[model samples]
Target: MTDLTGTSFEFPGEYYEIMRKDFRNLDAETEFLASLLPDAGTVLDLGCGTGSNLRALRERGHRGTGVDQSAAFLEYARAAGDEGISYVEARAEEYRTDERYDLVYSLFMTLNYLDRGRLPAVLRSVRELLNPGGQVVLEFGHLLNFVDSFQPNSVGHHRRDGVLITRLARQFINAHAANWRNEETLLVRTADGTVAMYDNFFDQAVLTGPEVRELLAAAGLTITAEYGGFRKEPAPFHGRGPLVIVATATPADTASDTAQQEENQA
Candidate 1:
């Protein structure tokens, strides 16, 4: 019941990077993404927080554009001075560009943040943004994973460069609605011995395997692969980890014909 929401300080991008450093395997993740794309291909990162993945991909010789709604995260990403990588402030679902990409990816359970009703729009946008033979990689929290591993409360502490951050988390699962709520409080101490607290919360829709497949299909995408983690571990229907999906867009002509047919029928 500890709520740090009363604190005035907003979560900064520097601290966000520090918080993720402990768990996020940047090399493995970038390798996985690289394996999916051709050499020197263009990439789009939806909900790309702080542009970490894009920055990593840029180093691997790929050009990347990242879109996120958080201005603080975008500001930090732009300040990194990474060549061939750019950051834009926009919601994933509403983001549109004349530029097509060889690959589009969303990571870190970003899709789960959207309501179920909004998934089609997001997926459709992804499909439209793909170049010929383009693919999309999505990472989301699977319902089974949450069911298998549900911890109500946890605490973590990280220290770097004279900054100490203590994070407390609480989670609630509503099976009936297939919803997961995570609340977090962070106490950050600077080198000057000044301390500040911040609170964050997320409500996620835990979609079933079938629901995910159906949504992808509805967006004119075909699943090419599925994985349980960053490694190429198979994601069985009853898997117990975050779902990583690889999908390719349907042929543009075919998709266009299907849309025309549907419109005519309606």
Candidate 2:
């Protein structure tokens, strides 16, 4: 159940191949994350665009299910699915699965695209979808990094499947607010000088580490490990770049049940 009218919008099926290709080299990060799940079981890959991480999970001996809103991506993922990989084409915020998972993951800054107010509900869903003691690994950009490294405008380029991706990023730095906007264009240069082009827009709300921690706490999940890089390096109080947050499931409404049990025992 996806709202057509939302601040966050994804190009239908348009970015699937590109995204899959772009993420193929993330094996190092995947291996790092896999190390955390020494005893992997059923794992939920929320916002699993193109099922890349699900592929990684299957390689690591875990049953994996992926959820995404992109019908096009799901189509590709289904064709790409292996023996134990399944995908659900639905919005991450609204997807419901009958089975509980031993681990849940929403990585690659996927949650940042969600509305701040809806984050608690998302985390609650993650917790509910997991078994007791299940863990969630969340990865996102470090807001402090943007504040510390403010480049008014910058450009970078990379190649994917012979397509040259040129990225131009702009920063808006103000007191209490720092905005980094990126404009990316992909150009595929054929041997004969022919070119194919694609464009996309991405915007997200800025939330600090403490704010994210509070939101997770409100969702009844306890933050067990917080790190700066995918390698699980310790995060400085105000360090930047990528951040990985590991949280374990905490049942919702524990206080009410505790009080009820106390009264019964009394």
Candidate 3:
């Protein structure tokens, strides 16, 4: 396992394996999201690590482009098989695309990487990068699930290629969301007394449902749906895994009343 930020180092070999192992459950979720878009023109994947999700979308017959702050991730994504995927190396806040996309997606709680203040800017950028009536699917772990825990939450032990990998993570909850700063250290113990170690930080931001709706609303978008898991199920007050939100960019005038109504009701 590499440090959470270690993915910033361009370690594609390690990342691809880690992500494949950890994100297996997101496949259904991604499919559900992709279904909401039109016969895609351009699909922008924010925080597209290893471009796994992007590749998945492409396999479904959509053209995909990825944006990430990690150069290592970008390098790895570029070399991914059956290439046509365009990858841009830039921070979520700093990167901008000249052309808007039919769909702009930030999956797996990538939005939580930015502080509350930065969210508006990021949302606006997504809005600007979206074609009119385009949809943006944002996914994240629900903070409400961990609101009671001041300690860490750890789970998962699966074997891969003769190596047994286990993950342990700690959770720190604050007003905004649960800061799950996971330290996933992979240790491979072998018969020859050989051991390998990789440390990575898998940090995620957990926001309340209202907080997410508000953030998108402020950015001139409307929330169409939210799910507790990848199955497109309703997100009750409590749930495991991530929150999947589907929003669409709205014009400035159309954004005002609808967003206010949602805020007041929430």
Candidate 3, residues 1-266, lDDT tens digits: the string is: 32333122334354345646566665785678678767745688888877877777787777878888777677777777536578888767778768778988887667877665678888988898888788998887565654544356665665555555555545433433445565556555544556665565555565777887878877888888877767877777545556788888777778787767889999
Residue 1, model 2: lDDT of 29
Task: Please tell me which model should have the higher TM-score, number 1 or number 2.
Answer: 1
Off by over 4 Å in 3: 1-19, 148-156, 172-180, 188-194, 256-266
Each prediction's number of clashing residue pairs:
0, 0, 14
Q: What's model 2's lDDT at 54?
A: 79
TM-score of each: 0.88, 0.78, 0.80
Looking at model 1, residue 233 earns an lDDT score of 85
Question: Would you list the rank order by lDDT, best first?
Answer: 1, 3, 2
lDDT of 3: 0.69
Model 1, 1-266: lDDT tens digits are 43221112237888888887886889889999999889899999988888899988888899989988788888888888658987888777778789999999999988887767789998988998999999999998887887887889999998889999999999886666677888889999999999998888877788877898889987999899988888888776665778899999977787788789989999
List the lowest-lDDT window of 10 residues for candidate 2.
1-10
How many steric overlaps does candidate 3 have? 14
Specify the poorest-scoring 10-residue window by lDDT in model 3: 1-10
**Model 1 stretches with alpha carbons more than 4 Å out:** 1-10, 174-176, 236-238, 252-266
Off by over 4 Å in 2: 1-25, 38-40, 149-152, 168-181, 190-193, 251-266
RMSD value for candidate 2: 5.2
Best by lDDT: 1
